[model samples]
Target: MTGAPTPVSPQQIPAAYQQALRLQNAGQLQQAAQIYAAILRTRPLAEPCFQLGLISARTGRRAEAATWFRRALEIKPRQIEIWTALIDVLDGPERAKAMAEAQRLGLIPSDKSAAAMRKALAELETGDPRKADRLYRKALEAGGDPVPLRETWARALFDRTETDAALKVLAEGLAKAPADPRLLLTRASLLETAGRIDEAEADLLAVLDARPYHPLAWLALMRARKQPPGAPHVATLEQRLPEAAADPEATRYMSFALAKALEDQKRDAEVFAHLDRANTMTRRKFPWNFEADHGFLRDAIAAWTPRTRGQSGAAPIFVTGLPRSGTTLVETILAAHPQVAAGGEAAVMTPLLHPAVEAWFSKGTDYDAQAIGQAYVAGMARKLGAASRDCRTTDKSISTYATMGYALDTLPDARFVVLERDRRDVGLSIYKNLFRDGTHRYSNDLTDIARQIRLFDAAVAAWRKRIPDAIHIVDYEALTADPEPHVRALLDFCGLPWDPACLTPERTERQVHTLSSVQVRQPINRGSVGAWKRFEGALQPLIAALDATRYDFG
Candidate 1:
């Protein structure tokens, strides 16, 4: 041998481990993560632990990063850099304590307000926006201009679905600093989510005017309007590509924006190229954990074994499917009925389901299926009472697909209206869009996305077989092509009286928070029925992967 390897690459390091390091250096974090995880399964190494922490940090998984760093520390307690990395991702008193220890190792300047800001961010991420609001206000009160925190605070509120409040926060910031691009962009997002597309476009344009070709602003612009084939923005996006090279994240957004612009122009090859670059960046940022979700399905199926359906009426209807399927459209249709309140893509069920069936087999938490169901119904009835006097509701949370068994058993009257679309279309939609960071982890890679769809179909098929009567199929193709019959059938299955309102779901008066928000506003059309054919050349790999699934949607 020439010489022994370094500490991180000791002699006889696994070939996989070396490959992971090379991939990590090349910015292929997701692939590196796969290799690192596999290596850990076979053998434990502190270096992989540290690398994982760094990877998690880059992906914005603070808690996960801290966990990996701590594991690294456990293996090699005196690694100063590992301690520093751990401190970087910690929050609140934990961060403070870690910093206090790191101080012993070296001199590092501490930002006095960072702890409070971190604590506030923790509150927002965990869904305690009120606490975050208070923390931000407290930070502003103490001293200094709190303008920097304004965008962050507004984002927290927006994430919690407090659209009006979030906008108000941004408006307040804009009042003081009228030309702040960050505030303008944040406001644009708020307007978009609130279904004020024109207003959002105006804000986005303002942001782009102040900071030309701003990457995220460009993406927002695409969503806000339909561009013609040689739109001015397309040329601007192309000419300014080199200017955005400094920020990889920004570059990714620019690619997505360019892709959208090219797509409108029907430049399929160019669209595919940009999408590949943007989606590759997304995968690096947040690697998908296929085994984790796979395990959830396996465990969930085991925990909630097959059972017959128990029935009720005009109860909560959960419209669910893979993202980009017709979940939003179905919910919009159901909401058109005066009796239904559309709770668009909300996580209300997450908290409720966890107490009932989340890892209960391992933890042995005592749960009452019927009582939980009763509680969920009562809670939803009260929750949607303001939206509808009858308190009938539609919950289109994607999690509905995963937790249908527990939900159906618990909510005696609840119905599941699942959308069935061609998996290729779903995969194409997922790959083409920029979803929220944590929303669709597998979306960046088409092969991974194909696997996700296959597994999703498996789960849905299982659920359908178990409780066929309780779950209704809304075929996306058929509904979009000839909507009236399907809409009537959907309404009928959900135990609602047919009304003319159901025929025009696009006219719904409910807050829609999905990528299809703009699409759903248009009259029901068959435009996207086989839109995946447009990308046949670009999507051959994904197509081949999916073709193996042997699936054809109803």
Candidate 2:
């Protein structure tokens, strides 16, 4: 029998490779690329190869990017991102083959039906909404797993502003998979989104009835409806918490759910106890390394500095900040303008920037930042189709904050609106919401959340100092207090003519897919401001962490 392979130590990693990473982060792509190439000559590693792939892809060399990604995957077969990158470059049977390999390696959903649904979802990610719609329909007709397929399809339809059609799709899925907890939970979420609280509660309850200890179902139920005096679920959740101890994931969910239920009962101490327990368990599962995140910010700040101008033209607006901040609100407001279309968090910037950054850092080569910027615009234009050509578009991906330095460097004329909220409130909101994606794992723990917020604060502060002219900071509270003037200023900053529709963002006919969807559908209000005050006592650790940073909440 073969023994386990020896793990590579930090000492074993070439210093040049480490330098390349630092250079890449700093936006010195050419210098970083040179270092990477030299290291590859001595040792062909997956990481450097992946870096090369990113550079290739960013330079509009899709075919070369696919080749580099394939080479990286040959070395590290389990790299899911490499597979995704490969699929992004290839089409037709080649893309299908790569996806099948991903499925076979268990990089994606393993079940055949779920795998097919994942492929359909991936098409949506590639900016092909029509193709995605067709694939979803084909999957449904071919008897793909009723639950995941239906849930994903419904979400896609909802995102496209076909709310009634999405509801019909969910209803049909529920009819097929009557007792499926996932389907039930999805329907409940949709109902909640629609403000049909009682119906949402009923659906959540149905999920719990079928699977008594379903964590998500229980959490959904708790959020869907307020508990009456002496709520019966308190005792049930308390009992299940101990039973769920064996499964950390279940314990995490049950503890948070019970905490909310206990809060409703005004059991402050007990509420905190449950929250602490849940956060601890969840944090253990996904630990955060603050030093590494901070280092990236430091490098980014050092790398992106004022340089000679590049070609300029109409550029897309980037609405970015920490998650749970007012990014969605700003995006929605901008999108409401007749001259603006919502791109809905299209991840076009990072992929384009990564490769260019790597190449720039490698050898200080003069990369065409204009070409990169125009390529991103072209990609978004294709995704948005001909209709968006007449107007500007907004990419509201919160994580795009990390790529802002590179973004401004490449697209010199691009406008950025950075949203700010109370750090304490932001932390609390992140904890309370059950994020649909795995990107925000840090939100599961207060300490990690605080650390993350600090990282964002540092990056924003640096950007403000370095590129103040391009970035506009919008405070959530200030905007909520009086939106018109702020909206007008924001529009003017983006060079858009004043439009009354920007003031009535709620009436805008666009599908919002973020947690703030429901909140943004209404006029600005102070309801969410200072929301952390209720749990102030329980959030001592988070408060202390933020205090250490001495960041201005305003």
Candidate 3:
């Protein structure tokens, strides 16, 4: 309809297929889909259907494409390539049905290849990643060339937090498929997470060279350079990011890369521009609204509020804000106090009160106010490893306090420290950090990152207005510029007597699973405060927007 839907003949079909692939590669997804659909409508060919299914999955219409693929397989049953498409399209129940159908017709070999895949899928669905890892490994042992199986096995292990094993698997795969972009990228991610930034750079650069438009690879390369234990590669990344951003997949990552680079250079405005582009791309690609868990917060508050009547221990000091916001610094300082044992960013509250939250939100069920409070105290004792009877106070710090009201409502006795930093700095740090997907995708662009930060800021502000004395706002700049005084004030707020040991934060031995792992080890500095100023000219739009919103942390 648009471009005279290229007429197909047997002679012209191959060229049409190649042209369709080129369109798909260039992010002309709708055009490519039309071509593939045209090719399949008349012929019902396995190749076209498989290609169409892949395009559909990538474009987020996997279910509809899966139907066409099933129809194609009905005609030509033994296409190995179709199996890959099949796996991409099928989910939990659909996957089992597809695998069984594949086996019954001898599409997959009778011995365990089909069964193993089903087992792995089941294990993954049931929330048993370790079992899925073992099943994927077993699938490889039973014969097929081991490329896909090994790749997925590594992912399963990585999901289970068995990083060393995951790295080993990815390393073995990379050795065999040196030029394979997926293998190279996976290894790069594993290395990056382990703080092997220099090594990760090599893999990411290789991936970019092979598939220069791969955005994740570009972003990874950007991050690997920015916080290198070695040298910064900002110039190289700057040259390459535009090229990557020209492609859709790489564009989101480029947004973040640009933001981080600008932030590192103290060009806050440029950082925001990059972040805005990233958010726009993300919304275009995957549009959805996420409702805040306020009802959950409300129920939690109702449960805990009654228990705090005329009763208090040095209450659980909640250290919360955006992920990279010096939450660990707050915890480390408090942990140094004789009274506080750090319950490092545990899932205690969510797990304990999640059901009550769901019930209240879904059915308006009444919840026991006192039991909710008592349950949380017990949950903290269990997770904090504090003796229930001997505990005077235990500090529980979960960065989820970006939702301050919900937390305050649930645990009214709980003290809160709302960490604050310049939005550009916070966003830049987030983009540079390797978060394990989900909400971390917000940091993939300056606009989305800015929006999320604004949302959190707005939420916190509203909460503070409602309960002004309930929370303490901690500015990262203040903490960095005057560490001792701020630390003393924070300790005093948490009702802990400050120790001189709290000042030498590096001396405290604790696992900080954040991008600032290296930064926190250094003595406090004013380095990050004005870091976004360097790219001021390029970042004017973002600066104007910030001014318009009046989000000045200064």
Best by TM-score: 1
Q: What is the overall TM-score of model 2 with all chains considered together?
A: 0.69
For each candidate in the order shown, give its overall lDDT on alpha carbons.
0.76, 0.75, 0.63
Task: TM-score winner between 2 and 3, please give it.
Answer: 2
Candidate 3 runs further than 4 Å off = 1-218, 225-247, 258-277, 288-315, 332-345, 351-363, 368-413, 423-455, 461-470, 506-509, 532-554
Compared with the true structure, the alpha-carbon lDDT of candidate 3 equals: 0.63
* Candidate number with the higher TM-score (1 or 2): 1
Q: What is the per-residue lDDT of model 3 for residues 292-379, given as tens digits with 9 covering 90 to 100? A: 4333344433433222332234356777787677787777676666566666666666665566556654677756645666666766
Could you estimate the TM-score for every candidate?
0.74, 0.69, 0.61
lDDT of 2 by residue, 1-554 (tens): 03333333333444565566668767787777776666566566787789878877877889988988988988878767889888998999999988878866545544555656777777875657677777777766554245556777887666555678788988887776688677778877877766566887888888878878788888777765556657887788788777654334566788878877776766766777777777665665466666656655665556665554444775789999988888888898998888999987787777777666655655465567778778888778755665477888899877767657678877788889999999999998888666653457788777778888988887788677767788998989999999988888899899999999888888886766677766777887887798788889878879998887633212
Which 10-residue window of candidate 3 scores lowest in summed lDDT?
303-312
| Cα RMSD for candidates in order | 9.2, 13.2, 8.5
Off by over 4 Å in 2: 1-146, 164-169, 190-199, 225-239, 261-267, 306-314, 358-368, 382-389, 436-438, 550-554
Model 1 alpha-carbon drift over 4 Å, by segment: 1-166, 306-314, 354-358, 361-365, 370-385, 550-554
